[model samples]
Target: MTQSGEVTTLKGESTDQIFNLKREASIYYSDSLSTFNDIKSAFIKSAGNSSLQMVFLLKGKLNGYLTGSKKACLTFAEQQHNILLINEKLQLQIKTETHEAIFIRIDPAFLSMYIPADHLGYLNLKDGMQKNEPALFSGCNLHMTSEIAAILNALRTSEHTGFCGKLFLESKILELLVLQLSQFELRKDDPAVRQLKEEELDKMHEVKEFLMNNMNQQFSLRSLAHMVGTNEFNLKRDFKLAFGTTVFGYLTDYKMTLAKRMLIEKDVTIAEVSEKTGYKYATHFSSAFKKYFGYLPNKIKSGKLSLLILIEDFSVVFENFVTMIP
Candidate 1:
């Protein structure tokens, strides 16, 4: 990833690059990501802004401890959260191997919109660091909902293939944001985390850029949240709003769309096509493939029917093929 901010490198296995997501914008955009990385990471430094982040681990681990506490572990498919107050030093250690994440950055001004000037007290927020050695918000790692997991899976398969490639990604990003923002009550506990600004919706394009470019790598939401300075909740919520669909929904369709294209435009073997599209097993790929396209991958290769006609004829043959894929 290209560094827009200060960046440091650790000597372990490293995969770092920047993705420039595309979207049409009118107003209320913030600065692009200044920093990002993915590796066996530990001890993240403080960001300048009051940060929001999303972190997910596809593999390897994370350990969080304060002062002299035993480590809180993050593992495969798990997510974690951390919020730091202003001017206070906090120690956080992250460790990983062949792990990855996707992230978005939000300015403090953007966050201030959610928290009013007066309620900052009842918010009981910290600026520096938590004083207690044993913490109450000890569950620093988050639990991603199934829906959130689906979206992350989708993010892993997004593609920038057409004029609307960016458009597809833009919408997915927004959907992710909306999904996350809907849960503000979890953090604020105010029961009134209001709707996000429409202008904020414009940032969905940035998210799309990240996912479409990084589709091949296994990406977890929490890992990304840390890199970009936003959290899983915010990404999901804003993504929903910006895209008008959940992240996974868009990704599912994108992958299936490519499958359909491969079925029609080329003579690649069903197994080859499946693996190329990132499916590991041909049998499972065939099942998922037919479920999406209403025909066997082999049948589609024959060029015997138009896609529209296949849908029309689906009522008759779909039931038969669905049973045969396995």
Candidate 2:
């Protein structure tokens, strides 16, 4: 391994890099850029060390099945993340196309040291680990957030060396894990979400789709609930459980994401983008954009801020900003 704790190997058209961090955590990154004719299958057998495994697929697709299961147990695509607790020996067959992914294996005991036993996330994880079955931390595949993307980018391009490098890498890994756990905790603590029937969950998804498709419009809790054939209270409660955010909260994030993409096009003005995202005034849209992204839309248009700087600013302010939003 290099002083940066990375060991790299190249086989055929693929490159794999492994970083061992503090003996309790390790990171595996793979990039495969091959045509359909050169596709490959990889078989992975778990070490059965009771570690928590987090996987992030940045590009392309991966499909896999367990050793005993006839059906595919794993399917990952670009911009998706999943967390699993591996406590027993298991084998997986994975087929990959042109893709880049990062896998992190962290000892649960190491996490326990940082997370209190009374914590809902730790308790849920502990219960799952004791069952001796592969446990999923997320109910559904999580879409990668800008914050997560930033941290992953840092991990991929780290420049620090030796002990300092190890420390930096460890800290980043822990930060990423904490973010995942917090999301799980939020959903787990929501009893309304836990009690949701399949039909109710479907309604929540429908609500989300409607909000996303109608960004140029606004809906109150009662109107959305009515449209989904549910009551306002159930809609408000279950929506948070299903998506980890309020109806309006989700809409605000969607609008901000769409606005950012629109701002990147040179011909799109702030006023036009604001209108597209349901903001009556450009100033209101700019204020919300700055709050969500920690920078004005003009910074993106001007190309003045580097991605690293934007990430740093966003990370510092995102938590506080989210709470300020409705």
Candidate 3:
């Protein structure tokens, strides 16, 4: 078994020698973030175990199932969280084109330092899975809030190294802990809300993928619900539970983020970018862009020195995650 904080590679056979593939897994540990990068061309399973782990999927999609069990395939989407209570029955078949995530491994004793006296019981229950015979794994699909996204993006893109960079990274990790705990508190009381079944979650993911792929096309909740074989109410409820944003809210943020990328990276005109991102009118697109990004699209195109300087300045402090999947 490969040790933690090291790389593991496996080569598999194929009909054409050129088509054979090698998969690599590496873990990087620090005081705050433990980043895991897995690049694979075929299926793979865990050879080593871990302590109680909180995994945040930052990029790519992965589907897997436990070995020697009848449970269905589990889908892990980008911007989601998975809580795994590690144990022997935790063998998994994780397969993806490429997978990258951040895993925070914690022991209950150490974690208690971060919890308040009032919340100790809650943390205890969550940590209780470690004592169970079979490992327990729970997952929640959360919308990447703009705050968390900004910090993550900065962390991913920063060029800084040494003690200063490490300090910045650790602060962001603590911010995520606060945000995640707050979000958890918001939902933990809603026992009336049903937890989505595996198939239901899969269908919701399909709905999300569809919306993302068709960003230029307009979609109504009713139409989307029908496309995903669900009713509108359940669709809205589950999407919010899984993604932490209303359907239209998520779509708008997505469109605006895409628009920013095009404005910065592509040589396309404002009208062209607008049409490409689903706005029929440039004025409407400009207004939405301003609202979302605090600057008009023309400011980006006309090379307004002040706004451009502002963006560059912010990039130093808060560059958004450039690797976000469109």
Q: lDDT per residue, candidate 1, 1-326, as tens digits? A: 22222222111112112134222211111112222122112112233323333344332344434444465432223232222232212333334334334443323343343334444321334332234222211122333343454455444444333444334333444444444443432445635334345344335455555665554567676765555567788878766644445666656666666676666666788888787767788898889878976767877776675534334433433343343233
| TM-score quality measure for candidate 2 | 0.58
lDDT (10s digit) by residue, model 3, range 1-326: 12242222211111111112221122222111121333121112232334455556655654445557667445556657654454454443334434555554434443454556456333543554545432323334444554555555544444444444434444444455555665665566667655567677777778878877887786799999999899999899988776777888877877776776667656889999888878889999999998977778887777554346334544533332221112
Off by over 4 Å in 2: 1-52, 55-82, 87-133, 136-176, 187-195, 264-267, 308-314, 317-326
| Candidate 2 global CA lDDT score | 0.62
The 0-to-1 C-alpha lDDT of every candidate, in the order given, reads 0.43, 0.62, 0.54
Candidate 2, residue 296: lDDT: 88
lDDT of 2 by residue, 40-85 (tens): 2221232444557677877666555555677766566455677766
Angstrom error at residue 306, model 3: 13
Better of 1 and 3 by lDDT: 3
